[model samples]
Structure formats: structure tokens, C-alpha cells
Target: MKKTITIPLGSQHISLLEPVRFNFSCENEKITDVDYNVGFVHRGIEKACTEKFEYKQVGYVVARVCGLCAITHTMAYTLGIEHILNIKTNKKIDYLRILMLELDRIHSHLLCLAHTAENSGFEGMFMKIMGDRELVMDIQEAISGNRVQFDFVCIGGVNRDISTECEKLAFTNLALLDKKVDDLIGKFTSNWSTALKYKNIGALSYDDAFNFNALGPLARAAGAAIDVRAESSILPYKEVGYKMILGQNGDIYDRNLVRLKEIKNSILMCQNILSGLTEGEILVKFKGKPNGESFTRLEAPRGEIFYYLNANGTNMLQRVRIKTPTFSQIPGMVEIFKGSDYADAPAILASFDPCMSCTAK
Candidate 1:
């Protein structure tokens, strides 16, 4: 006997957790096909980038694309506009941008990790991850003065310098984080129930992972080793040096492992940037409008974020579009979830830690 059911999952989408809907065709409690629908939270961000608002003002507007990725959005926009303006930023500016970017990574990843734990029904571990997350948030608050919406990026460079006080507090949090992460590593591995639950669940082979076009920790956990930080040297990333984090098995456990390993790298990157502070102007003056098209990409905590812009030498003349990694990888969810039992759906979905606003924005 065979049983088939269609579970239309969500306006508060479950697959990638981004407010999209998916028509899931399941048979005998196993999903078969997942048809996706976005545009649920379309704020008309790209549409709003038209005229009326100056290029500089648009930076703040676009930064609101996703609170978690505010800095990355701003950086990408600023870079594209500068490229069109033919402005070359200095070395110090590049380093500062990267520092801010890494700080965002720490905050975003920690929050998502906490959520993932909650989804897995691990209440104790969930709280622990969130408790450690406060350290990163504190550091972010100290740096840009606002943890979530760091409106500190301007057109040419960052709006503020790395103060000594800021550096000290950030370092303190990093040290505290070191201790907490060590504790978490022990718990995640030793919690036999959790280990068994996540070990081989939602498995993906490297071939399937590549075909799905996964990015960031998700791709790395599957042993792809494809990181925009390494592939694209947009900032002063080449200076401090970083190794791509990867895992042998592409499963829920591997994703968790990759993210945990990345947290340490992010902390070290932040500390190194603060210690090697260089003296240079944070903001630079530029005149006129952009005249061409340009694209920028960054390794967001979830995955790769892509921004494409075209300018026409006017205050409000251009095109803007962004491709979020979650949206790109949504199809892959269908592939992995097809044979998975209904009970495991939510946990597997959360394992990707998908951010829907970011996806649809």
C-alpha cells in the first residue's frame, strides 16, 4: 500500500525559514517535491532605490534589506557605487570593512546556531548558544554603537574609527567566547542523544551539494571548501590569512561542526584586525554619479550573497538586485527531504538555518 499527501508548507516558510511558501508533495510521510513561492515580504527595496533618495541616502535604505546583513548590504552597495565613481579606497579602509563584516558573521551565525538548537529540541544547548551569543552582540554594540543596524558605513569608507576602548571590549568578549565555545564543543559531542540525532540525518554527497550550489558553511560542511572570502579578496582579508573550514560528511552534524569551527576564525580575525590598526581616513570625499554596472559578493553567515548594480551617471539612475543564498539553495531542500520522514522535516530545515527576509530581500 502507498499513501501520498501534499503539505503546503508556509508563509513563514519551513524549508529555508524565509517567509516563502512551498507545495510539498509527500507520500507515506516522506516529501517528494517542494514547489516554492516567494514575494511574501517584498518591501520593494530595489524598486524604492529609484530617484527621490540620493545615493548616500540609499545606502541606509538598502542596509535595511536585512538587519542581520546590514553591514554586508551596505558594503556591497558602497563598493559598487565607488567602482562606478572610479574611487579607489585605501588599505586601511579595506581592513576596517572586513573587520565589520566578520563581526556581523559572528553575531549572525551565533543567533542562527541558537535557533537551530531550539529547533532540534535541545533546550539546554539552545540557551547555552544564546548565552555565548551575547558576547558577540556586546562586541558589535561596542564597535559600531548599534549591534543590529550598524549604520556606520558611508559611501567611500566606514564612518567611524576603531577606538582603543572599542578594541579592548571586543577583545574581552572574544576571550570570553573562547571559553564558552570550548564548553559548547564538549556538550555538543558528549550529548549522546544529540550526537545520534544529527549524525547522518539529511545527508548530502559532495556531488549533490555541488549540483545544489550550496555556499558558506553549508557547502563547506559538505567538503566543497568554496568560500567567497578566499575566492574573492574584496577586502584586506588576504592580510590576516584564514583557512577554509570544512567537514568530511555533508550532514546536519557537519554543518554544525563547520559553523563552530568558523566562529573561532571569526573571533581571531576580529582580534587581529583590531591589534593591527592602521592610521588612515575612515571616510573619503567623492564627487559625481556612477556610470556603469558592477557586482559585489560576500560570504554571509548563511551563505554567499550577491549584489548587482548598474548606474547611469545620475543621482537616481540605476538597477539593483540581490541573490540570497537561501533562495538559491531552496531547491536542494526538496532533494534532501524527499525520502526523509515527516518528523525530521523541521529539524532538517532549521539545520540550514535559513533566513527568509534575507532570502526574499
Candidate 2:
């Protein structure tokens, strides 16, 4: 008897934890052609903001677009709103905004690390990484009253500010986290088997990536210098120092490395920001509504996030659109998975850190 087996992983897969499709042609150990079909469920978040909600309401709406990227989404929407209004908040508002965003990165990176660890069958490491990340999440909640959806930002400025005591608490926590991150990174990168497992095993070469027009870690993993944070700061980000991390191999390993290093650098930036905290107002009052079109670009944890809004001097926005990082990364994912082995596909796919909701929205 002869049997032909064709295993298609998705438009839905268990590892993905989201609705997305992968059509994999596997002949024994090798994957022949990998075709990805994303865009499974696109929630109409833009309409929810522009049509249903008021200008002020859009911040929280956008923030909730991706739970992992809540603050980043919130910031992107707020920055867009601010652009339309041409409003600027005070100094303390800037520091708090940057601080919350960086903390979100730490949390997001930690979750990625944990998930990657679990995917690689290192459950112990996963548990420990997740454990270490809990404090950061707690710190996030302590600062903003919610771990994932902080709702920290409003149109004019932030909703809360860190006091001297809060600063002292954060200082203690970040100092400890810095040391742990160094140790975890040392273990992740320095181990021979681990290094080899990532370094070139899931290699994503150049041509395949560009065709997809991928941005963020997915593109950066392919050796693209496409970081939005390097030279541009959307708000008062110029005052807060950030180093853009890049990888040349464009493999799972390089992405893991970039995320790890970026997390460490974000921790350092938090320390630097906390040391310079001064007394000021958390937010400003924007009594007048906005008019005309406005666009905003922010360096989110995933990559550059763009928001566009058209206002008509009304309570609600005339139009709104957000181009999330995940949307840009999908095409690149399809390209890299083309010829990889079936076993290696999951890790390869996860390296991009796709957020389907963000993409669909």
C-alpha cells in the first residue's frame, strides 16, 4: 500500500494561539512549500474609535488593540490624537510615558522568552522566566493599576505619575531585574547547544524577507536596518535614550538575541529616567476638539506603529486607521517559512512575534 500525506498546519495552529493558517507540504522531514494565510478575524477597531467613540475614548480603545502591546497601542493612538490637536503635555508626563512603555517592553519580551522557551521544550527555563517577569508585571500594575491594559495615557498626557516613594520602589525592582536579565541572557546565549539550536537552524535569508515587505523583528531578523527608534522619537522620546538592537542572521536566534538585548537596554533606560524624575503635572486639559488630518508614528516593542486620524471639530473622530507592526511582519513570515522543515516551522514563525488582532484591526 502506498500513502500520500499532506499536513497543513493552519490558518490555525495550536502553537500560534491565534487564528492563522499555514499550508505546509511536507515530504518526510522536509517542508517543501510553506504558504501562510493570515487575516483570520479582523476586529473593526478603527471604526470602534473613529465612529463610535469620542476622541478621548480612542486612546483606551487603541490601547486594548493588543493586550501585550496595550500601552504601545495607547501611546500610538494618543500621539496621533495629539498630532491632530497640536497639544503637548509637561515634562513629568514625558518621563512617565516613556517609563510605562519601557516596562511594557520588559513584560512583552519576558513573555516572548517564556513562550520561546516552552516551544523549545525548556519548560523549567520557561517557568523561571515567567516567574521573573511577574514582578515587572506587578510593577506595571502598581504604577498604572492594571498589568496589561494600563490605560496610562490620555490625549494630553498620562493619567498617573510616579512619586519619590514609587520611584524608590521601582529603583529597587529594576536593579534586581537587570541582574536577572543578565544571568538569563548569559544562559540563553552562552550555552553551546542553545546557541546552535538558534544561530542558523531557522535561518531566514534576505530575498525571501524583502518580497514579503516585513518590518520590525521579522525584517530585522533578516538583517534589515529598519528600526523606527534609531533616529526618530514620536513624543519627548528624544530625551529618553534608547539603542536599537539588530541581528544579521535573520534567524530565530538573531531575533531572540535582539529581543533579549533590547530588553536589557530598556531596563537601563528606565534606570536613567527614574534618576531624573522631577515634580510636574501628569496631564493637561485639552478643552478644544481637533480638526483636519493627523498622523503619528511610534517605536513600539514589536516595531514602528503608525496612526492616522481625520477630525472634524467634533467629539468623535471623522476617520481613524492604525497600521500595527504585526500587520507589516506577516508577509515576511510567509517568505521565511517557505522551505523550512516542518519541525522547525513553529519556532521560525514565532520569531516574528505576530499579533493577529493588531493586524486584523
Candidate 3:
């Protein structure tokens, strides 16, 4: 008889950045079953948004859901509120929003790639990716006055406008990032060692992805062709040449490739935004309190993040619900782990880029 042992990863582990605990039941060296705990980082932000903060302040409040995709969180919430208020923002505001969104995507995808490389025992690639990621961070800071939690997006429009100096800085840094990302694409695609560790490992098929309702990179990697940016009209994603990147294998390597290609595409979108930016107001005024239900969706770094809001014509909102990508991908995550080697678990998890804070919130 084969004896099975259970291994626990995280709740506090080197591979994980947030509080996510995974219990893997292993038969010999293969994972047979898996369980995960995501409530360890729950902060009750949903309740707090409606109870503690007013409607206008909820944008900044939801931005705390996750530091990496804070812009997406705020933008989704603001869009929901704007929907409730029926505010039509100007083209300049929309362009600025897309610029920041793509910047966030670029940095977030780089971080995921770096983490995947580090987990796969490629420390040098990890360092190189990390170093290149700062170019995007620098542009983000130059535009938003902060690196992580910019709070740039708000109801009606954005809080800050891009200046000529900021535009110059953005273009310069993006050029550097574009070159580095191209190099990364070559390395990830051509490196044999990367393939050995990543190819055919932790693969999720299209059927499995659809059955599990996988979102974001995981779904795209499986050739699911589901992206909120492409589906939703909330933003001008079509106008900015947003193309969905897909993969055939849906393994760790495919996930990395999808992210790399996404970084390249995001860079193109940012360049387009900067080159043809129109002159208009960043923020528009909307009167009266929110009094209806509304929802909005946006493609975050990991996947699609959704926001639902209910208002009662008062200072405080009635309800705020957030359905994050990581949370939705949990089932798909567990499914992928069932047949993989225990040793490859960390690399697989890192590829999914699970954000427990967003899940537990």
C-alpha cells in the first residue's frame, strides 16, 4: 500500500507573500488532494466600505484591497459609483485612466514573472525582472505621486492630470521597459531550463478552466478567450488597441508567456495614450448622493475584478461587494494541483499569482 502524507505550505511560507495556507495530501511525490485557507488576511473591507466610509471615500478604501492592483480596485469602485450617478467622463480622463491601468498591469505582470522565476530556482532572472520592474514604478510615481497605492482613479474622473514633464518621463521609462520585456520574452521562450521546470507542469485545460470559472491569466493561458477589457464597455480598451493574449498549453511556462506578451501589449497601449493624449479636464463634478445599485468590472493584473454597490441616497453606501480574480480562480487552482509533483507546487502557485488579501477581503 502506498502511504500518503500531508504537507502544508503557507499561512506563512517563503513562497507566499500574503497569508494563504495550502494543505496538500501527497501520495509519494505527487499531490493527490489539496485544500486552501484564504480567510487569514480578511480585513472586512467590504463592510467597512459601506459602514465606515462615505460613497466618495470608498474609492480610496477599496484601493487597499491589494497593493499591486490598487488602481484597478479604485477604478472599478469609481466606475460603479459613476454608473450609479450617471456621469460621463471626458476623453482625457478616460485616456489617463487607461495609462495608469496599463502601467499597473506592466509592473504587476513583471512582479509575477519575477516571483515565478525565483520560485523556479532562477534567482538571476528574478533579480533582472525586479530591477526592470522599477522603470514602470518610476513612471507610476512620476504620474501619481506614489508607487503602490496611487488613488489616482476616482468618481467622475481621475484625481491627477498628466503634465508634459510626466509624459516625457513616462515615454522614457516605458522605452527602457519595452526593451527589457522583449529580452524577457526571448529568454522565457528559448531557455531550456525554464521549459523543464514550467512546460506541461500544472496545466489546466479549456474544459477544466470553464468548469472552474477561471479568470484572468489562468483562463487566458488555457485559451478561454474571456477578458473583461474586451467584453466590457466600461473603459475605452478597444480604442487603445487592447489585444487579448492567449496560450495553448496553460502551464506555468504558458502563464509566464501570457504575462510577458501582456506586458508588451500594455506598453503599446501606454505609448498610444501618451502620443495622442487630448486636452480636457481630469475630474468632473457630479451632484447628489448615490441612490441605486450599480456594478463595474475591470481586468486587473491577475484577472477580472468586479465591484457591486448599493446606495440609499445617503452619505454612506448600503452595500459594497467585491469579486476578485484570485477568489474566483481558487477552484481552478486546486484542480491543477491534484496531479502535479509536490516539489513543483510552489512554482505552480506563484504562476497563478494568487492574492489572498483580495480574496479574503
Please report the candidate that would top lDDT against the real structure: 3
Query: What Cα-based lDDT does every candidate model obtain?
Result: 0.79, 0.78, 0.90
Sort by TM-score, best first: what order? 3, 1, 2
What is candidate 1's lDDT per residue for 1-361, written digit by digit as tens? 4566788777754334567676777887877767767778777788788655767688899888898888888888888788888888888888888888888888778777777677777778778788888888887788788868998778888888888888889888899998787776666666764555788888877888899887777788889978888988677677876778888888887787778778888878887888888898887788877788988887787888888888777788477888887877776776888777767777777778777777666
Better of 1 and 2 by TM-score: 1
Candidate 3, which segments miss by more than 4 Å at Cα?
none
* Cα error of candidate 1 at position 248, Å: 1.6
Q: Is candidate 1 or candidate 3 better by TM-score?
A: 3
Model 2 residue runs over 4 Å out of place are 1-5, 206-211
Candidates arranged by lDDT, highest first: 3, 1, 2
Candidate 3 lDDT over residue span 326-349, tens digit each:
989999999999989999988899
| Model 2, span 1-361: residue lDDT tens | 3242467776656678577777776677777666666678778888888778888888888877888888988888787778778787777787888898889888888888777777787778889999999878878878887767788888788877776677777888888888898898787787653455777766666676667676766667677777766756665655677776767878877788878888888888889889988887777887788888977777777888988889999999888888888777766666666566788877776667777778886
Q: Which candidate ranks first by TM-score, i.e. highest? A: 3
Per-candidate Cα RMSD to the true structure, in Å, reads 1.9, 2.3, 1.1
